[model samples]
Target: MPQIFFLSRPWDDRDVTWKFRRRPAPAEPDTLGGHVRVDSRTKNLTKRLSAGDVAVIDHEDIDRVSAEALVACQPAAVLNAAKSTSGRYPNMGPGILLDAGIPLIDDLGSQIMDLHEGDVVRVDESGAVHRGNDLIAEGEWQTDELNSAKMEEARSGISVQLSAFAHNTMSYLEREQDLILNSVGIPSVRTDFDDRQVLIVVRGYHYKDDLQSLRSYIRDYRPVLVGVDGGADAILELGMRPDVIVGDMDSVSDEALNSGAEVIVHAYRDGSAPGVKRVEELGVPYIVFPMTGTSEDAAMILADSKGAKLIVAVGTHSSLIEFLDKGREGMASTFLTRLKVGGRLIDAKGASQLYQSRISSWQLVALVLAGVLAMAAALTTTEVGQTALGLAQAWFLDIGNWFTNLFR
Candidate 1:
């Protein structure tokens, strides 16, 4: 049987589609070549693949995870859904697979009629390839060096860019997050922070209700809002502004920087810097912490040092898959960082356990007003008024149905 894996989300767009789905039963056919679906954003999707797993990567998701996943899969071959190797859109998957001894099969998703597992097939890398023992020629051999070179060039561009981002930006943060978490000794700071506690927002992991659950707590506890790198953006999404934004400054958007948050630029040990310039250009106050780890780690450390009684973390990674996505060893750094956190380092996952229900009384008042307006419009004789009523009714009905379905 060909084992097939399906990627749940695209690589570049991790922010919107990072939610975990309940595992579903596999329906794909078993082939001699195993089919694996890897998320474009999954850091180690390709790196963790075993031999014989054919990785199906989205042609659009040209990032390190996709490249690494393709390498890790070590598949019999790769199938490009996009087909064309040239265009504005990126196709990093095909090139990586080809370089790693995997055959590049373009448009296999549309061309193949049917295929099964364990089928004896001869790949004609010398010319056009054939699937199974049938020796059927599905495509022509490429003679153009330029077209092939385009593939290599595309792959190289993506690899270099992602490697730089990961090494300089992401990896730095990961290391820093570890250092603070692992650093032993609970030293209290003399700084009088405005808040009683602090909220840390991480980009990935289970944070669906993290912000929502903490809404009341933010008001009651008066926690200093802190965002780690892109976690700053996540903080804004929750209708909260961060007091401090920590990271190497690659993934964060300009809107995040302009949100009146103080920036803390994570610098290298030897005094080399990138984020300092950006923060200065934005006229944001920033302090450089030259460390070997992630900004999240630094945030925790800063919070502890600054006299925070409790540190609440939201959307933080706490699983094997997540750690592997980082392409790191065990969470030794995270373990150590936690030791340095005195008082409480509460994981947001635990906070999600409790729930409080409340009625939106304002919604009822709005509905009644809307009904009166609709009734008033129904009595109008003008064509424009009738059209407006019809549109309003349709919109209300659609919204009502949507809400009703949610309950059902």
Candidate 2:
């Protein structure tokens, strides 16, 4: 048989090498005992993933957000048909899985996609996958040492990533300058953010803990709560109703759409709202905001234009790594959006560190009572107090005598 040839680039240098990963999956190892939940789309697959289930996906350079979603599902292992990290920009998804103690079998190729849903398969120590006595598919099982080495290597590409990031910012600014500088495509909302603190929640890193930390803030300020896509479900999870739900409406639940929250469909720049039909079918009245950015950016712009005094963001991206974690060039819009909404917005991801415990009503009442008793004690010890007490006692005794005489 003739050897196969394919061009591949090494992470360190800009050189191509003849390498092939599509060769009939390295003869599947002899093994048999695992169940896999398969989906080519990582996002969709995650929704169906449950504890102890091995997740099979085809995500290349899996980002941090996707990693977190997978970890949240508590999968037993992960099988990827593509490179978990292509050395593009030090993607952390694979590292996150390794940290979570999940076995990540990487670069198994497209043949792995053939495994039907709910099929019983077994993965061996050599990273080979088998079904009954038949060899199915196989790949490299990433270890902490290997993942770290790759991460260290990818760090060298940061300068390139930053340069590209800068270009993206200018590109977005050029296209959406009108939307950013002027209130161009923003729609009017009845939720009324005017003079009120607005809380925008996104389903992102540490969102649960961040939301819990805001219990006091939310109760005290009662800010208009805005949820972006899956974030509406997060709002509902807290037994709180969202004031407005925004996004393409794909990740958000039907219940959130019907929860009396004003629904707004985030449409593409061309005015195509994929979520519009779902809203119509649910009999929920909706407004479409045609924009060129992510739902997160749109929500902040809407709140700012609507006159929100302060915007406390929950589970939103504030760091460079997280902005890059979505693995989309559009994230450049987020950087610009942040600059536009400056001073008005604060990220609550760091809420744990910033959160101050509020004094309870019971404590305040006890303090007041103690103060009153201390004052009474001080009064009794003073000469002027004794005189006042004597007069008050005489007046009370006289009143009591008069009442007794009248009753008799």
Q: Flag clash pairs in model 2.
A: none
What is the lDDT, from 0 to 100, of the residue 204 in candidate 1? 48
Estimate, for each residue in 53-99, the C-alpha lDDT of model 2 and write its tens digit: 77889999997668868877877678899999888777778866665
The number of clashing residue pairs in model 2 is 0
TM-score for each model: 0.46, 0.78
**C-alpha local distance difference test of each model:** 0.56, 0.81
Q: Residue-wise lDDT of candidate 1 within 262-324, one digit each (tens)?
A: 777777666566998888887876677766555666677777766677888986655423432
**Which residues of candidate 1, in runs, are more than 4 Å off?**
1-191, 319-321, 329-331, 353-408
lDDT of 2 at 163: 90
Deviation (Å) of 42 in candidate 1:
8.4
Superposed Cα deviation of residue 309, candidate 1 (Å)? 1.1
